[model samples]
Target: MRRVSIFVLCTAFLALTLSTGCGGGGEEGPPDSGTPYVPPVPDAGPPDAGPKPDAGPLDLAPPVVLSHSPEANATGVPPESFIEVNFSEAMQTSRGTLQIIPGDGLPNNGLLVARPEYWDVTRRTVRFSFPLGLPLRAFLTVNLANFADVAGNVTQGFRTFAFTVSDGVAPSVSSTSPSEGASSVPLSTSEIVINFNQPMDTSVGTLVPGGGLSLGTPSWTGNQALRAPITSTLVNNGLYSVRLENFRNINVKAMDGAPYLGDGKLDFGTGPDTIAPTVREASPVEGATNQQYESTRFVVFTFSEPMDTNLGMAELVDGSTRTPLATSFSGDGFTVTCDAQFKLRPGATLRVELTGFKDRAGNALVTTPFLGSNGALDFTMAPDTVKPYVTQTNVPEGATDVYPVEVFSSAGNPGYRKVFTFRFSEPMDPSVTLVTLHDAQLPSSFRNLAGVWSPDRLTMTLTISPPSSGLPPIEADKLQYLELNRLKDATGNLLDTTIPPLGDGRLNFRTLLNQRELNHACEHAETQGPLLVTATSSVTAGTPRSDVLHGLYELTLPGSGNTFSGYTRAQLITNQTQPIFMNGAPELTVTDPASPQTGIGVTLLPVPPACPSITHEARFGTVASPLNLRFSHGQQRLRIVLEDTY
Candidate 1:
């Protein structure tokens, strides 16, 4: 069995030697064409070293600041200079943090934070910039932290740098309540407010007022504003001045900070009015009697100066009752009118009391309640039962040669014909007061009259027009009469017709004659002598005598027949010069009788004589006399003397 095993091992060895080559160096030949050759693969040591995934290198170094402007511990740095920081290596640009804090060690103090504004293309350099400069004279600290590298390595701790900004400017005034050179400032300004451009040190500064101005202690607000109270009353229309001295900023420096050198003086002016107002005059004057108690009646007060209408109040007191009156001011503020809102008692004495009145310049009235006899405005109210009567009229009782139309184009009404105006003693009711015009040539039933009342209903203007039918136009050279019948006052009082002449509501007047007759009469009177005419009655005509009356003829008036107290004279001179007299008898002159002829009229020179003056002229017979001296129309030969008092 051993010999057979040896033979098997020799056979294996001989096969291996035939497949492997010997150690001798020799070139190999090509393999047989029947089989293909295969190449061997190289061995790798571990699975981890064969074709691993790509990942960046692990870095743990933090970023550092390379350089910074306004270096640490720097002084005298300009406030307008910008702060800059440069990083040493590339950083996580968005993750960096920087802080500039005030070095006062106070919490809640203002601070500045740095933000990166630029980065290089290589991502290795980062810079921070400040656009708006820093605060003046500020001690600031720059802190750097939270800066990370691209590999996620943050800064370990904070890096701090300290510096200071320089300042050479002084504080200045920004504004004032009443600016410099201001005018019309109120005299009641209680305080003055001052604003500064920078925070100030109020402990060391002083504010002084001049020009008779007084001020109290000043207080500071927010280190930039000061308020000073007024210590005394300011004068009206006065000038004042103020000044600031030794004013400095809160930031103290060596040898004391430089003081403000700008304009330190402030000037202003006050208002221009100060006089108090007083009552100058009043209507329905004090102690007045017969004052009508009607709606149109107003109690008016005139002031010495313009008043402040909004500030005053007035009231009307009647016996024990007090009532508020509606007050209104005139456009000029010089007159105040009071109207009663309630009905006033008849025959009662009333008083108007004023209070709290002031002028435009804030001056109170000199005398309260308008100082009077009893310290109030007093007037007696007229009884309502008093009858209304004619106070005056445009056409008197014996007015002659009066124009038919008083005003032709009145109030833009070209056709409005006003012949007569009748004024009443009190406001009358137009509904009850009736006016009629009666023509001597027209029938009694022919009524052709229209009337218009004044705004206060106290006067009536009569206009005459032809009737719509049957009546002819108003004829000239005829007698026209006006009758006011059934007249009543505003309070229903009947008219009092017991008075003389027009008091009975009757007025008689003669119209002018034709132009031809008037011309003929005027020619005849110019050639005729100054004839002697008789005076029969005060308001009537008398026949003429044959004797020529020349020179001055004096006539004494009786006391019981007239309101005159002196004698009157008639001067009938044709071509003589006037005679001047001194305190002699009142005289009437008749020299030129041809001109201004009305209905065959004779012109009387100085027609109305002056006695105790013209207001109290002597009458020939009665109160209503001497209206005109003329002759009857169409009767040139027959001369007559007519009344000539108006």
Candidate 2:
């Protein structure tokens, strides 16, 4: 160990001459030639922790320095470089006691802060690189007695590291935000925060885009500890550019392997640097239930652009007549009104055309005749269809009877049939029950609910037995008409539309002569086997009338999706009940306009009631002239009509 100490001292003496460069002299014999520093040995008297015994013999010595990176006078170190020293032996990792004081840049000037470039631990060397290699004279001074060795020994020394760049150059400057090849950017980037190598004079920045709408000059303001540039609001839905156009002329260039080492550096040399902001599709195509086609009072038009109202009435269309209804426009307006006489005939179609609406860019539309993909563009109005039907003529088509002597004819001859049926355009509620039987008035309590039939399936039968007692006390045997409004066809649409309605709502009859009532043997209801009876007299008024003298149930075929339009009066015949079902197929007939001579017969409606809505329809004519009654998707009901009445 003594021999190594001597060798170390010899090397230090030589280094002192190499850097100090002092000539042989008297008082300054040699650097580090002064009295050698020594540490005091521990006191042995009672081993007390009192003031370290006054000055025993100097026996303890501090560890000596071995080597350092950037050896003694290395040059061109980066700003982010570190300083490190190797002791004569292994030491502890104590960083707080170690530091490198930079020669340039103010304290905490966002530069030269903890610049630990990299550490070659295997070789015990630390280094930091500069933002850019700089060419300036910088110094690294280390304090004394900071770090200690495993032997509790520290270097009793203060050392300095200084270097100079031979050539006169500075650090390189680059901007990252307003990128070099960028064409469009934020025109109002208020903070132009630029990063520097060592330290920089950050009093240069500008903003404000103007003149031709390019980037404008930015106001340089060091706010919140930053070299910021101020500008106005950014362009809405468009793009603009920004640039470090001008600043105080401060120049800098990079040293080979270090940061630019110079002060007062700003926008040394630079000039200024535009993206188009696009349209996304419109909803509800042009001709949808749009403003023109929705029942005059229910149309609306919405667009993606600031609509121009000058184009006016050409925006929407009425599907039925293809006529133009004036359209009123508003930014947030969703509803509009139309003139009177707004109605669509049932079983009709319409077309909606649009070709003159303009966009915000004033570009006229490119598409026309836009139809609702859902097929709602075609709406039809129901036509007038209230015709009294000859539901059941008990007297057949022709018959007669004589009085007194010869007496009224037999049951068949006298045309004494007592059952009949009929239905109106719409249905009447049984709640408002009405009836007029024979020549007497009967109460509803004695009336039974009539059975209904499907328009799509026209034939039906009532499994009912009417009661019979005797003639009524009032009008006896007149047996004239049956009056009742308590009959409806599913939909609440009523059968009567007039204030007082039309005629007597009854069918006439005729009777034949030459027959007489047989006054044969007689038997009462009890004596007979549940008699489906024929009374000897008409219902007596003021008496307990058992049987319902009158009642009615109806069905129709002339609404939205039915099949009864375009047929001449002759081809239309209202029937008594639903037709027969053959192996599930219905046997039916209607006057098909396509073939008028003989009526058309079929098993199913040309169009069927598809679930909640009607798909197939009744055909009184060719396809174009068929009626369209339907079971609407939302309205869970079927409509009925007296087939030929429309």
Candidate 3:
């Protein structure tokens, strides 16, 4: 109506639709495409949002053989050939079936047992190989079935292939009965068996006996063997030869279908058995002395050859008395074991007597009883009844300053322990050597006792351990005794505890000063030193009565005219030396040749103090006691304190 152009009219209509209020909406703007506005129906709340539908089963296919080696019905295959199968698709090498069977419908499982499955690099192919060579000149069938693929697909059908192996090698004798050039063949030998290296044809064969030997009909005994019985009377003692013949016949060919290389032959001689079995060796050999009866295991008697035990008897003889022994023979009758229940007495000889024994050849052994000879065995039972005596001991009776082999405590002082060893004249049974350690003054828990036997079983080592509690180092003056209550030899003989009239297995020892300290203090001093004595100024003697410190001196009493009566005395006290504290009991020898007392010697004893005095009083004179001096009546007694040199 306003005469607007068509394009202008269309553009105005689009602009109006595109502008606000184009669609029938009350509050919201027009639709994006200029169409009627319609919502998505609230999304249907996630499209029904319920359980998912079942997926059902998957589609699978079976695996099939694509190709194989030695293709079906192939011929002239090697006897050791491997049967291979290639699948059409990848296969589960582990999940498959393979079988090797004879072409003929025989159920020969040996072939299947002989072959094991092997897979190629790709795993899609399987191979079967026989470790042992396959049967010769035979048609074999290989079957593969039920192989699976990666997609769970099993082969729909099985596979079968055939192959024939050609024969090549011939069979020959590997060994023979009566052996080649055999002699001394038993006249009673029953049969002769021939063994072939390779299996031979069993259809037909023959045996030709010659050289005055009569062999019975030949018979197949095994796949690769034949045996023939020797006619009893015809098997003479002279030399004879036997042969396997006619094996070259087609029916009698080897398993490889080849003729036998040559006839097998054996030559041997028959003779009567005459050699007797002798005593080849013996255990605890003849003349074995000091043998402990308790330590005696089974005695063995080895024979030169297999013996006949039908009438065998053995006895162990002690002087005129004979004791039967339980005897047993080894498998080959070449060894005999003899056992006895009673133990042999000490310092006694046992003679073994074996009689009525024969060899496999019906020959008898020497029956005479001989001493110190292989013909008769004898062993002297070690004199265990004499009782095991201690040849040496680590700690002797009344020992002093023994270095502690183990931990000990002495007057609150810890001491090193000493290993106590008891060496016996004969081997001892440590198990029965009851060793009890206790304080000499009183029974106290001052010991940690442990013992071991030397490898030779003759020395028993008893060691002390540190006390669990109480004192540590043992005191030097600790009195202890080790009582070996049940000391015994290997034969159970008790120890000679009554020797020297001491208590049974009781050893009394005293611990003294440490040896190292004592040795260091008296390194160069003679164990026994000269005693020196002098008179004090208050005395009538020429010199004051004094004791010398580690000194040698002379003492002279007042003499009327140079005839001096001299006496010497000294005391050494120490807590470090053996027999710890004591005085030197000196002996005096006058050197004056012209004097009446010349060459006179006397040993002086220091009189003990009457009370608790510091020094002892001693008098030297020819009184009731021996003395080197006849003192003048007015001579004074000397009171001297000597220095400890050790």
Score each candidate by Cα lDDT: 0.58, 0.33, 0.57
Any runs in candidate 2 off by more than 4 Å, and if so which? 1-297, 314-320, 330-346, 368-646
**Candidate 1's TM-score:** 0.29
Error of 1 at 2 (Å): 99
- For residues 1-646, could you state the per-residue lDDT of candidate 2 as single tens digits? 1112333445666668667755665575455777874533322334332224243443346656676655566555444344555555544444313334553453333133222334344323333343543324555554434544434455566544454332333333333344333344453444444443333234543433332233233333342122344344433234333333233222322222222212222211121211211112223333333223222433344443344466634323344245565566564322222222233222244433444565543555433233345322333334333332224332332222311011123432321223334433322333433444332233332334344343421222222222442321112223233444444333333434232232344322322221111110011101222212111111123112111111110122122452222111221123422221111111234433445445444335422111111223333332322312111122212222222111
Name the weakest run of 10 consecutive residues (lDDT summed) in model 1: 608-617
- Per-model TM-score, in order, reads 0.29, 0.25, 0.25
Worst 10 residues of 2 by lDDT: 517-526
Q: lDDT tens digits, residues 379-449, model 1?
A: 88887877778878876787777544221332433231335688887777877646767775563843546
TM-score winner: 1
Candidate 1, superposed: residue stretches over 4 Å from native: 1-357, 363-382, 402-418, 439-450, 468-473, 498-503, 513-646
Candidates arranged by lDDT, highest first: 1, 3, 2
| Candidate with best lDDT | 1
- CA shift of 204, model 3, Å: 21
The Cα error of candidate 3 at residue 49, in Å, is: 99
Q: List the residue pairs that clash in candidate 1.
A: 625-645, 626-643, 626-644, 626-645, 627-643, 627-644, 627-645, 628-643, 628-644
Better of 1 and 2 by lDDT: 1
- TM-score of structure candidate 3: 0.25
